[model samples]
Target: MLGGRAVTLTVSSLADVSALLAALPEGEAAAAAAAAAREPRLTKPAGSLGRLEELSAWLATWQGAHPPRFERPVARVFAGNHGVAALGVSAFPPEVTVQMVANFQHGGAAINQLCRTFGIALDVVALDLDHPTADFTQGPALDEAGFLAAFQAGLDSVPDGADLLVLGEMGIGNTTPAAAIACALFGGEAADWTGRGTGVVGGALARKIEVVAAGVARHRGLPPLEILRALGGRELVALAGATVAARLRRVPVLLDGYVVTAAVAPLEAARPGALDHCQVGHVSAEPGHRRLVGALGKAPLLDFGLRLGEGSGAALAAGLVKAAVACHTGMATFDEAGVSDKG
Candidate 1:
């Protein structure tokens, strides 16, 4: 019923997702306070560590410990094909989605290398590799049953014993659907919500923008779930399910880039404050990603113009999170170091 097999679910609607979705566990405020209290007593000037200190405290609060442990950090890359890829939204063809899934399986993708470098476990979820979704510009991307199925498949992919979960996606032309969903949910012009995905420009970029505009215009005024049904691909649906599952299980999620961020957008709108359990891995080169990150009200941990999905950004940021956890737990306090506290 949870993570693993895509079993049949009683959940048939977004309301079901919300009803079954538990809010993130109330982080240990006492632990966070304890961490902050200890920081001042460490053998260093106050606030010298800057964001690292804050990150440490956040981990403490999330884990209910003054010094949290970073055990079993994992990343999952959800790969699928979008029917909108027929529109040339991305420079890469839809076949590239299948090819890249192979790359991920062979440990040749950026995310695979990054995850290996950081000693994180990696799983590539290919739910729609051979089964692409319907083109949204023409009709609903997935039927209600299909959407729920994809959602469950994604929900089941979150690994057990994971201290932190990183979510990413690979779907050619997904940016078109992501942009359409963002425009519908966030109320922005299609051009504003769209971007130069995979470096498509000039005429290709113009057509991509037009596709998004038409898709959003057709699906306007729909509810969050309807918007997803109209515009979301299998990978995006799965990403959203994974995000909801993470929040329900009290696992902190590191979202990769634009597609992942857009996938979580509807949840934030539906659950209100659900994103408190999530963080951005990076500010991607994709323009909509900035708007998506802003809408979530969370700052990215890094900004290296990364637009390559497949959990690449999340893998890079996971290392930083692990380091923050180590610093929180391993550093010597003034008392432990026999150093005098500030008088």
Candidate 2:
């Protein structure tokens, strides 16, 4: 049994995870070059389109075409209750994690609304909540078996025919674990990585910082995967797995804010080029998020002071990606429009 629940998977150790994920097919360089060449010939001032041009080129490289398809985007929100929530880290209770999962299923959450607006399908993977991982401040949050199981759940959650993926998470007190993971990976003080998740402050916030610091102190020198095993919540491990899986599948990933970013930090560490498969949808208002994004070397598409998770930022950014694709494909060249090029 794993996480107080039975979990079935074929793999035994973290090493098997690398075997399960192959390198992302290098996005088509020829196609990207061709798209870049076409952009200059378009009936517009040079560089007038700004980041849309970059987005289109990115899509072209990944899709192996000048005009890439951005349809059938999928958003996966992994839900779990963190054992760290037993501390006063979050303003919300742990049960809210389960309640939010139901809200996601019932189409009542903000993410559901955003996904509907963007016409993206939503999938929520619920981890074993009957037994949340142990408090990482004292012990490993998940045993090796449990961590492997959550990782597999992430890999299994990726749906077929998804042109792109948006990753999100729902777990009360998750920020504590995420911050702990970041601190371990980035070599920072607990205060550098910790943030006020769900708006906890004063004594609650101080306690949260202490808890993350303790977790980081307890497991500072472990391997990347072991740090994840020791300090990560089930949902976080699952999201990291999903990011790697999406890369292997050659699907681009739109990453949601802080917690999600922290979850993937170790994956990026384990596989150096893996994060090239993803783009940040937005930077969360959470302080640790910006540091993590910088660590990944990604510039966010939006920066609206959003701290809400559950794929809200990713869903909003998907529309912009789709628009970028449309503009890249639909815009006419100077030759086609019979307009003379500026010599």
Candidate 3:
């Protein structure tokens, strides 16, 4: 029901989901157990270090080995325009979307710097979800038909054998529509999720809240497809489609923030198991982002109170995943190290 072209598999009951979850590799758990069993002898008392030790063990389990590797990780930033910018809900003008896209292409944005620092491969895709006029220039600037084409293009662009994928956004007024989409999917008032985006102050914040509420009100009884059409951006829709494609290809997706999460909701609705492929990178400063994460039943890895929305949070967290993999792969088990399991 969420992704227009997605095929809904017949899942009759909760048992089906249980079966699916059961079939997933228990490697992470096994790795965790192994890591935990080895920690007491590493010149530390049992459980003295608390969460960091627990996290290391957890990563070992998730990687399904005593040590994990996050080598050759990739971050993909998806860019598009939201039609709601016309509603004047943001401080920056809509042209900033295109300008920022150019900035990203030129390797000048925060994500670029962070990814370069971490040695992560970065990929950018433009989704044609809205028609930007001469007044507004950054694009996968597409009408409905063009959006569909761009969606397919995004699906095709994913590289094979990618260990991780981080989805990010670059639309100027996208938070307005992102909040609207969140409200529609999760049954909340738009104002509850709306927040000041991009340093909007005073009257601009109030206007943003009002615009989101209006969009939610307008799409109240509409179907998901119609709601997306009415309030969604090209980037959101393309990300949703790309999420589905990524799942089919068996790659993990790291959601950057509220906007990227909202864009990928249709994928969750379309393929319920698809959510398993995603990891939320962080809790965003955007008010709606927490609500969205709650709706998806996901806990973010970090919270730096970020509101930048340029894959900054996701790029930042990539280092953690790498460390996780390193600990999982490099640390020896008690049996291998000939240490007693007991503290």
Candidate 4:
């Protein structure tokens, strides 16, 4: 079983991965209809809960069950170092990735606290802290074998019977690669996708934009999957793989902030409905994140000027999703509550 789903999927190459994405399994129609039918009979005015109602239905649609519940939610944070960090694109050094991963492992990070608060099982996957990918401006970040390895690692990260998956990433210089991937997937200039990741500003931000532009220019017009190998890191590709694994397993996904969004953006571009089972957990403070989400036509569940990676935003949003599912599953129907139907 692949992530608790009975499917035989072999992803040895990007072509295989692309083909898999192009012909992905769809969500359950009956479960979606069942959730919709149950929504209006819950003794409340129609459309009162706004996005919460949609969240419940989304959970049902993706989970393929009548009463959707986020019982076994898992949060994954993929951490990797980047060769492009040598370009001075970030305010912090690349070694920070290792430091942050240790923090997460030791339960001292914000994501750790948030995961505990929201009752999410946390998994921190370090792609390769000692070895960073090749600098994109010089050449591809990862070769075919390397990319596939990282992708498979991501695929293997998803747990069995997880009703919900929350994805995030940690890499000091990852925003540069994420911006480059966004620029390649969507038609945009470097400045349009690049932002002040790691609090770089002034000339530092300008340097980051230049680096993203150079990477895109060197590897532009490649296929969507190639764009990932050309400009993305191991953690980024792993996030994409985990997203695919979750969808294939029929588990709903809550995507974290900017880097995570950019990591999985190529899936949607390669196939339109690739991300139908996923939602933006929260919008990050990175300016490019807002534009990227807009390009994906996604409405984030929350916006609190959050820019911390490592699945923090998604973990916070998990509580809200749990509440949404609770209301959908536990609320009494009009007849059960002795409430009059809308007449």
Predicted structure with the largest lDDT when compared to the true one: 4
86, model 2: CA deviation in Å? 0.4
**Regions of candidate 3 where Cα sits further than 4 Å from its true position:** 1-68, 128-130, 133-144
Local accuracy of candidate 3 as per-residue lDDT tens digits, 99-159: 8888889999999998998888988876542464111122212345544554555566556
The number of the candidate with the highest TM-score is 4
Q: Rank the candidates by TM-score, best first.
A: 4, 2, 1, 3
lDDT by residue (73-162, candidate 1, tens digit) is 888888888888887888987888888889889988888889888888888888857778988888888998889888887778876567
Global fold similarity of model 4 (TM-score): 0.97
Deviation from native of the Cα of residue 312 in model 2, angstroms: 0.8
Q: Candidate 4: misplaced stretches above 4 Å?
A: 1-6
User: Taking the tens digit of each residue's C-alpha lDDT, what string does model 2 give over 77-194?
Assistant: 9999888898788999999988999999999999999998888989888999778889898899999889989998888887656788999999998989988998999987899988
- Candidate 2: misplaced stretches above 4 Å? 1-10
In candidate 1, where is summed lDDT lowest over 10 consecutive residues? 1-10
Higher lDDT: candidate 1 or 3? 1
Model 1 gets an lDDT of 0.82
Clashing pairs in 2: none
In order, the Cα lDDT scores of the candidates are 0.82, 0.85, 0.66, 0.91
Clashes of each: 0, 0, 13, 0
In candidate 1, stretches whose alpha carbon ends up further than 4 angstroms from where it belongs are 1-10, 22-24
Give the worst 10-residue stretch by lDDT in candidate 3.
133-142
Q: 81-100, model 4: which lDDT tens digit per residue? A: 89999999999998889999
